[model samples]
Target: MAQETANSQENSNDLGTITVEAEALSIVTEGTESYRAPLTSTATRLDLTPRETPQSVSAVTQAQIEDFNLDTINDALESTPGVTVERVETDRTYYSSRGFEISNLQVDGLRLPMPYNNVHGDIDTAVYDRIEVVRGATGLMSGSGNPAATVNFIRKRPTDSPQASVSGTLGSWDRRRLELDVSGPLDDEGRVRGRLVAAGLDTDSYLDRLHRERGVLYGVLEADLTDSTQLALGHTWQNNNTDSNMWGALPLYDSAGSPTNYDRSTSPAPDWSYWDGETHRSFVELTQRLSDNWSIKGTVTHLDMLSDTKLFYIGTVPDASTGRIPNSFYLSKFDRHLEQWVADIHAKGNIEAFGRTHQLVLGSDWSQSRVQQSSLYAAATEDLPPLDEWDGSYPEPEFGDPDFVHDVTFKERSLYSAGKLDLANRWTAVVGARLSWLDHVGEQYGSSQDTTLDNELTPYAGLIYDVTDQASLYASYTEIFNPQTATDRNGDFLDPIEGTSYEVGIKADVFDGGADAALALFRTEQNNVAQLVGNIGGRDVYEGADGITSEGVDVTLAGELTPGWQASVGYTYLEIEDAEGEATNTYIPRNMVRATTSYRPASLDALKVGARVRWQDDIERERDFDDSKTRQEAYALVDLMASYDINENLTASLNLNNVTDEKYLTSLKWDQGFYGAPRHVMANLTWRY
Candidate 1:
């Protein structure tokens, strides 16, 4: 039936161009039509276009990555509109969109489990061809989750032709890196192909006694088992080691509320403190073309993570003489392990029914994860440790004591289906739903029992209308439900969190060339959100107390507006409020803007120069008790890149970040203070064969 529908569509196209053609109206054929097709036609089976996807979607392609010299996943995503990246440590990072943290991550369209604050290593952008982002509630595709957004990393595939590349980089703070990528056919019949990527980096931080070393290895193999069957196997390994890692932000103000800045060279950790982490992932996928228009795919993945660290947290102590001013104390030691497994099956096909064409997708996902931690505390120390201790110049000291161990396990299962119907020549509609179940168990080595289960259903709907051949308008509504794993006073798990989002937008190929642009207005509401009322020592205890609402507008322009010159611009206007808390009407910035432009003046055949700027409006935060008292601030950053191609196979590039050397914070909190990164420069040389 699906094959018949596809044939009918092809037949209609042929007939319209021949027998039914009218001289009054001419069908315009653009040479670049194939280039403008949805991304699904490019190495993946998912049809996602900015205009047809029913949500705000953004794609960062390989050209953009190379133009910006993006080395990591976080670096590549920083240029995306409505997205923010914050580095917590050398190896840990956080991402948020529209005032909410994004938890849904996908590799090749398969959802991966994201435990609380867990960062996975399988998302390295160095081995990917592109990155796709879908904003707003993704329940139709992600099952149970927050209403933030979803990030999909598309891996690089082996081309029919053989290619290889090697790059070396040197940067500020004595940083050095080397990377290699190679791809070719593995069989004479061209039935088997493979690609391999590897990189190593060593760098020193601006802060005293801080340094890091990291490496990654990735490989993918594809085999055509038969005329209609294919299989792929992939593996990734990453290791990171850091000395004197920073955990908390630095203080931004003195006791009198006067602005204060810490020296960029200051280090919060003792010279003896260090952190080391290792991660490994293995994945396999099978694809079968059951028919011309119907296909099924299955995937399985496993992940392992381990970390060992000695951390220090600064504390205040009373002075012996004045008894007013306070001295400082530090607490430090820890080991952690995380393991996960995920499996999924997906089926997609096309059907003709109700006098229209419909695209249907059905899938099921199963995931399991386990997390364990063991921590030790250090006794009070009066004597300071020497900075050179980290370099093996000083003897080690025993300052800590042993502590207890904790373990937690999380399990999730989901079933979902979605469909898009082409109702008319210019109208389309999409509807979908998901059913999910989750279970959690927390056990203390010698404590009481804890276990719980949660289940929920989520739904989505959207509509799109083509106002013209070059423009389209769309509206969508989506919802999400996330289960809570924390136990209540009665030792019972809390109910799941729920949220909904509404969005309307217009998308256009403005120049009728390869250029694309979009403008969207969105509003989201979250209910039963957890809020912290008090703290048990250093840990925060939260209860489901209040609701929150956010409204925003997002604008983006990308691709080539003209030949030899390319530009990308993004802007967001947002309003966030606490609907049910004492701190209502608190505004979260509301304005953000970013722009990038590159030009190759034709006269300079081998030279290309680019510049980018980002700005954000002031964010106002008021005290819960005294609404009149507040803090407000804004920031802007600039970066530049230039590259020279010596030949078809050789290129050299230079990058300058924070060109103005501005001192500003990326994130701030009253309790944790402020976090920021300093100005830096990096240079790279690449050779391709």
Candidate 2:
């Protein structure tokens, strides 16, 4: 849908060109309808525009979400530059950046842990105003993670004036979607504001017998108390349920290690198979402004997740000539519940140091989680079908009591502080550190384990030199901490993996800050990483190696080009090697590119058109059941969009994805994988008030 810019830009040289004082709209992108972000705080916890930050940052705005029809978290991050979305299963996904997996996700700057180090459900993006990504280790602001990247979701907030929108979508594969969003003040004096968003989707898939249903609801209330203090409370809920969901993808090769050229729609899932997930989150925050430039905030949050799945897997390879394929007969059913709670307090302000004003932030946070899971396996009642003649028609299994159960608890507490100092007229420096303590206790599959690590410290430092009003040069060093559960050959738990990152870059606010550009060179290292040894008594032992090293170059640009033209583009070049100096993480592409742009012509005032192009180099993975490797060649995809205003309060839009119909595997992370969706089309109609 065509949207109007919420904020205006007046001059090119003024650093304080736009003023946003309210905490609710501190870094607002709700109604901006543009890709360029005015401010970001993910890297430092201090409000700073993207140009002023030392690290590489990127954003997917509401406009991009609307234009590209980014329905799920996977779709949004998949198009993001420098990010790789790995779809290992129908409902599970893993994201990576800079050749390492992203370990955490944040909502409104608060970390929310995931289940099993993977995304379980299809997270809808309708309630979010924008998504921001900060590349590299962020130990100062974020508690702990890899050196890949951090994703922070910005929720849509109540507007000063009342507004509402309703939209419906229809697409290929009998897909349908509906959404409603509204925001306004709660009282005549506008002291209290409220906002609510809801959406639902039901869709069939290109893969046979795969169907999905998803729903989302979010609501928030903000109250201004005593003119200087503010209180806000919010809740969000989402559910994803799918039928005929495959436990794994179609077999990539036959019994002889030769590639199996199965049709893209082929699948091994039975009609009775399903995977369902639900998540609930509630949060409350209180903020107090002490002065014109100083503020303090405290927050508490709780999250709950539940999952149920009935899955089937066929690991044995097929024999095309003999039609003598032997499918695994053991099916499984799982039920899991995870709960987490977190609390944090932070203060940010300006201080006069060394005769110049500087920025500082201090914070402390605590989190704990409890997880319980159980599973049961059922033997196949009957099986008599060849690969060529098999459909998703099968009888449901009669599952008995759970035969395996696990219970675990994890706790972490941390304290962090950071400061940005003005060293000279053209130079600046940022320094920070974090101290954390972690504890884990669990009983898993009849094994008892307990681990603790205390006083873990990670440091961060950066220097920036202003080359001109529009450009700056910078270098930074950061580190992250990750505890391991693997055991060494001596039956001793290994130490935590320590990730260190080094980077140098240049940033420019070109076109008078209408557009932004950045170029960065980065390298990262991990130590004490686990390496496997021979198994003993059905238990695999491991050894700690020096781990791996990744180095890369990244370039990004995003902003309004002209009157009605906007573009966001990025390119990445990466190389990763292990201790032996051989290529590693070969499943991740070494070269990737993402480019998108949109334009609204003055002559065609009511029309807007846009396109997005994505390209990646070849990627390969060594098969687990065999020594052979599965490889997917380089390919490109093209997606197109167009929108037209039918009236003052109505708009119509259409999106076409994979227009070239390029066939490619979703990922090679596992020996079995499926192809991506084919050329698809969708149309949307929205009404606003």
Candidate 3:
């Protein structure tokens, strides 16, 4: 959406002089709304507007979440641009950006480690107000990760005025959802406040006999110890359970290496297969303001996560005509528990430079995690049932207790500092560095192992020039390192992976700062990446690659165009090559686009309508087993939504996703393929007070 301005001109010969004025809003005194979340703290731990920060950043705000009816983090990320998603099974998903998997995550400025295989990718978004993403390396703040991107979740806080909202939803596949949120002052002076949020969901999937149940609860308390000091404590919990979940994707080919197109509703999971997960988190934060431009903050967090599953593994594809699948008849049980502690302390202030003001921040952080896991697998001697027409039902096996397997611990500590200096009239410089240390230990089956990585420094630097009142040009360089756990053929861990990133871009705020836009070009090079190799004697091995390179361009636009219209659009183009100069990671699209817009007519006052669309180029993958390549054709999906206000406190809404019911593959890897979801419809009613 674009705002229009009218210009008037008068002839001085026939009349007096005429004057004209610009209609754009001034940045000095403008306030941002929910639809236009211009300010973010993800870039440098400072509250700077997106245009002012020397990086490419994007945000999905509360308004956008409500408009699109996004219920989980996976949904939100799938809708975000420059990000790619792959589904391994019904409950397992992975995300990547710019040809690299995303692994860095933060909550309220504190880093939180991501689980292996993404068992927690289905986190509910009800406890968060906004999700911010910064594209490029973030080693200055996160310490270690890929050069892809960093994601930060901003939690909802207590409000000064008493407010409450409740919503109920009914959708396709017997889906049901309910949510409640309340926040207000706990005392008359508003010095003390509290907030609570809760949600429950029960949904059946398009895959036969597959279903999920989830529940979440979050609560927080904020108190003002003094006028310039604040203390906050909060806790969040989530429990998720799945029934008849598939362990992996359906087969993609038969014995003849020809395609076997499985129906979208087909699943090979046994009736008794299940997976369950639970998480608990507690955090405390304190902020002390030494002066108007100086402050100190400290935060501590604790997290406990547990997961358990029982599944049946299928190893062979059935004959297309027989409708019978051969199985190894193995029953497996697995359990994992993780406990983590994280803490950070920092101080930031303005400093006097060469006749100008500058900014500086110094921080230190420590994190530790302990993980325990156990598993058991038993092979059946008897032949499995065969010749049965494929259905989502099978008899449960009798596999009793199993033995304990593994225990592991990991620790990390770091110190970091960053500064922004006014180099000249229209130029600024940003410099930062981080020093980190890592330690890990593992014990399994009466064997012990330990690894330590020490004294690694990551550096960051950037340059910015203000070209105009509402536009800026910037360039930056950053470095990152990641430790690998994969072992080589000799059963020894591989060396850490290293990467460097370079970026240049221009960002602008237009239409009186009512809209924002950015264009960026970036390149990244990585070394010592782990590549899969053949398995030997029931053990898998990997070998380190010499190097890989990725280059890409990104364009983004967002904000309010006029009085009642809002829109967002983004496009990405990326290419990756291996050390042999061959195309790699072909599962990710080389080009993609995402756009959404909403409008509310002034005459209709209480009604709103919107639409969304996603398009991607063709994707190709090569099977390592058969040395055959397959390609998925280009495709697009459309979604529509509308809402009406019944009164000041009540509203009703409807969302129809995948309107055309397009059947397409979302991911292709190894010898398996995954199908995208079909058409879905959701209707909701909400009440506010």
List CA RMSD, all candidates.
7.2, 3.6, 8.1
lDDT of 3: 0.76
Q: Which model scores highest in lDDT?
A: 2
Off by over 4 Å in 3: 1-33, 115-117, 380-389, 400-404, 443-449, 485-495, 530-545
Give model 3 RMSD, 1 decimal: 8.1
Predicted candidate 1 versus true structure: per-residue lDDT over 1-689, tens digit per residue: 00001111111112111211111011111111111223431111235456776777766666666767666788767777787765544445677777677888777666766766436332456777667777788876666677888887766655444778999999999999899988767887666777799989898877777788888899988777776676779998888888877655443443444333545565556567787889888899777777767778788999898988876654532222332223254454778898999998878777889887788778888988898988776665353332222232222346455577778787888888877788889998877877888776776554433444445778888899999988999999999777664444444455777878899999988765567789999997778776656665554556775576778999988766666677778898877777643433333346888677677777886888887777877654443322333344677888898999999889999989889877665553233334455789999999988
Please give the ranking of all candidate structures by lDDT, highest first, separated by commas: 2, 3, 1
lDDT (Cα atoms) of all candidates against the true structure: 0.67, 0.83, 0.76
User: Which prediction has more favorable TM-score, 1 or 3?
Assistant: 3
Minimal lDDT window, size 10, model 1? 1-10
lDDT of 2 by residue, 1-689 (tens): 01123454111111122121332236555555577777777777777777678888998888899988998889989778999999988888999999888987777777665535678878899988788899888777667668788888878776656888999999999999999998877898766778899999999999888999999999988777756677789999999999999887778887778887777787788899999999998999887777777778888999999999998887677765664457465689989899999998888889998899998888999989898999888877655365446787777788898998999888889998888889999898888898999898997787765779899998989999999998999999999878887888777788888898899999999876799999999998888898897787777899878887999999999989888898889999999999898999999999999888899899997898999988999999998767979999999999999999999789999999999999999998888899899999999999988
Q: Which residue pairs clash in candidate 3?
A: 25-512
lDDT value, residue 196 of candidate 2? 94
Candidate 3 lDDT, tens digit per residue, 503-555? 89999997677788999999888888888887877777898886778899989
* Every model's TM-score: 0.86, 0.95, 0.90
State, as a TM-score between 0 and 1, how close model 3 is to the true structure: 0.90
